[model samples]
Target: MKLSILDQSPIPYGKTAEESLSASIELAKMADTLGYKRYWIAEHHDMSGLACPAPDIMLSRIGAETENIRIGAGAVLLLHYRPYNIAERYNMLAVLYPDRVDLGIGRAPGGSAEATIALSGNFLENVSKMPETLDELLSFFEGNFPKDHMYSAINPSPVPKVSPEPWLLGTSEKSGILAAEKGIPYAFGHFMSEQDGPEIVKRYHANTKSGKSLVAVSVICAETTKEAEELALSSQLWKIQQAKGEGKKGVPTVEEARAYNFSDEKKNDKIIAGNSGVVKQELEVLQEKYQTDEFMIVTITHSFEARRKSYELIAKAFGL
Candidate 1:
């Protein structure tokens, strides 16, 4: 199996955003040396726990620090920005990193309603025009705009020798259909979605020209299954609280999570927490269901060291 990473740069309870970002850099460098295929930073806005709002900016810095791993925005929320500007920013990264850059595009707001309006005046309108925007963005990369088109003469520069590989990220079948129609690579957010992932992936492959599919999953691995579950408590509680419109101060400590009034009814089954062997077995089950060989793992824990260790254990488990 080919392993990759999706970093949200989660801030621990008492840690600052700066510390979270620094940890992301350290993680990326570690992933590069561990033989992971890619390192993707997610973009989120106005969220204290998830520190990164501009993945493009972070990717520029990460590319400089990591030697070989492909660095990218797991999904640059394309709804808030113009295609040309998005193309230009990623193109610059491509110039700097050569073939090790990816441009993963998604249509979600990636923020709250107020933040969405602040970024783009009409988020709904932008959603309606996604097809056109995606077409224009792909054209900028392929340089295939018609001669009479308004953007034909313009270039998203300084263009690199190799264009960034573009991937469409989604959690639903609509995204799969769009990716298939566009003929680009597809990345399914299995960690976040409640939909039928195998069905979506199957449809994407049935019609997709690229035939490339990647499943991004939330996972936590440790020396023992009990240890992994204990480490995952903070993240699990944070998510539960966040769903109830709280937890803005970042991931809480395990002690805090343990003290919380969370009940079994609020437990999150999405996070796959276990020992390395158990985690590998669960991932293999997912692989069989999704019929894909690549998985992008995302893990968030209160302790940075534990988070790092989780990735390390997973890497060793997969022999990456």
Candidate 2:
């Protein structure tokens, strides 16, 4: 199995955004040394817990700090900006980093309802235009704009020797279909949706005529199964709050999660948390079910140390 990481650059309680960002860079370096295949950063706007609202900037810093590990956006909210703009920015990064860049674009608003409106000025209209925007972005990369298209007369400059590898990110079957139709790589957001994993992967494989498929999973690994369970609770309350549309910016402590009232189903869904051996076993089951060898793991923990340890333990378990 090829294990990769999806870092949110999450701010733990009482930590500054700077600290969270610093931790992300440090983690990227660690992942590079640990033999992980890729390290993708997430973009979340107007969220206190996540510091990486601008993955392009973060990618530059991460790429500068780490060697050998591939770095890119987990998903840049495609609805917020012009496709030409995204294409140019990442193309610039590709010039600097070459084959190390990956651009994963998604249509979802990466923020609250209010922030979504703030981002694009017109949410629904911008979302409705995502397909066209994706086409424009790809045209810039492939230099294949349709005849008479406005951009056919123009070129996004500073084009790298190797263009960025673009992947469509989605949590539903619709995303898979669009990706397959576009003939681009598809990354299933398994971490975001528990019920849709098996079906989404199946559909993506069946429909895709080209490009590989990847799944992102939420994982928490620790020294012992009991300890891992305790640490994993940090996300239970956070998940509950998110469902209530009251999710906080930073992670809740295990103590806070223990104090909150939550059903077992919500707490366990889409999460693979346990000791190294247990995590490995659970991941195997998921891999078998998804029929994919590539997995991008997202870990949410209260402490930076714990988060790093989680990845470290998992990497050791996978022998990556």
Candidate 3:
């Protein structure tokens, strides 16, 4: 029922890291004032042009500036950090911000072959463990959850838990299964998730341990079908460029994003765009397809004003 933003510390193709951070700070403040549920940052490391490699560092800065918004990594590169350390860092932040911090987790580092190796280091064997490694992570965050509890029909609250909201973030069915089996929330990376965004959500809910947790994450939402298509194009361009292994710092403005070309088939269902009525209809369809009434949308516009306006319009339409 709420919306959110996934800012990539977007350094336009030519901007400096400092400039990108500054722009993100401004954008965070704007989102905070607008009453968005959360503003999550993506983590991509070691790429010569990407700057948001460390979301924890950036999150502290975002948290320091915002009052009510839940600031977090749309995903932390869980495969890169130690389970114990991840727990401790997020626990400290949760204590500092209380209920406002979310620990969205993803196996991917949002980078390349070289970047992944660099991050894993000797931890390479660790990443290979996969879902087993994933269990350790969830247990660590739950603050001392024993290894055995993860396998049996067990609940995971036993110690001074690092209870920041937990979310399994990815585009695949595996991520969805992880969320449901563990009783955690699931966030599909719609920006990069290759179709079946709703189906992923459905799979998670169907297997949910107790069906008590709220299931949702961030997806770009825009106003007017045309505006939506335009913003989606911008997002798609970044995806395309990033996939081609072109790394850049900072986020791109709407204008900078519109410079690329795309096909309707590629974007038609990937993003949600429309006026209030259109938004309502579109979201309703998405909600039903996902089998959940809750969702977090990213009101994407290339310009700040347009983004803000899109937020306002969606908020009013959603009655949030």
CA RMSD (A), model 1:
0.9
lDDT of 1 by residue, 1-320 (tens): 99999999999989999999999999999999999999999999998699999999999899999899999888899999999999999999999999999999999998899999999999999999999999999999999999998889999999999999999999999999999999999999999999999999999999966679999999999999999998889988999878878888889998997787766546778899999999999999999999999999999999999999999999999888
Residues 72-167 of candidate 2 have per-residue lDDT tens digits of 899998999988889889999999997999999988888888999888888888877778888889989999988888889877778899999999
lDDT per residue for candidate 3 within 223-250, as digits (tens), equals 5677666665655666555556653533
Q: In terms of TM-score, which candidate is strongest?
A: 1
Worst 10 residues of 3 by lDDT: 151-160
Better by TM-score, candidate 3 or 1:
1
Better of 1 and 2 by TM-score: 1
- Residue 260 lDDT, candidate 1, scale 0-100: 75
In model 2, residue pairs whose N, Cα or C atoms come closer than 3 Å (at least 3 residues apart or on different chains), thus clashing, are 49-249
Candidate order by lDDT, decreasing, is 1, 2, 3
Q: Which is better, 2 or 3, measured by TM-score?
A: 2
> How much does candidate 2 score in TM-score?
0.96
lDDT of each: 0.94, 0.87, 0.67
Candidate 2 ranges with C-alpha deviation above 4 Å: 263-265
Q: CA RMSD for every model?
A: 0.9, 1.6, 4.7
Model 1 weakest 10-residue run by lDDT: 260-269
Ranking by TM-score: 1, 2, 3
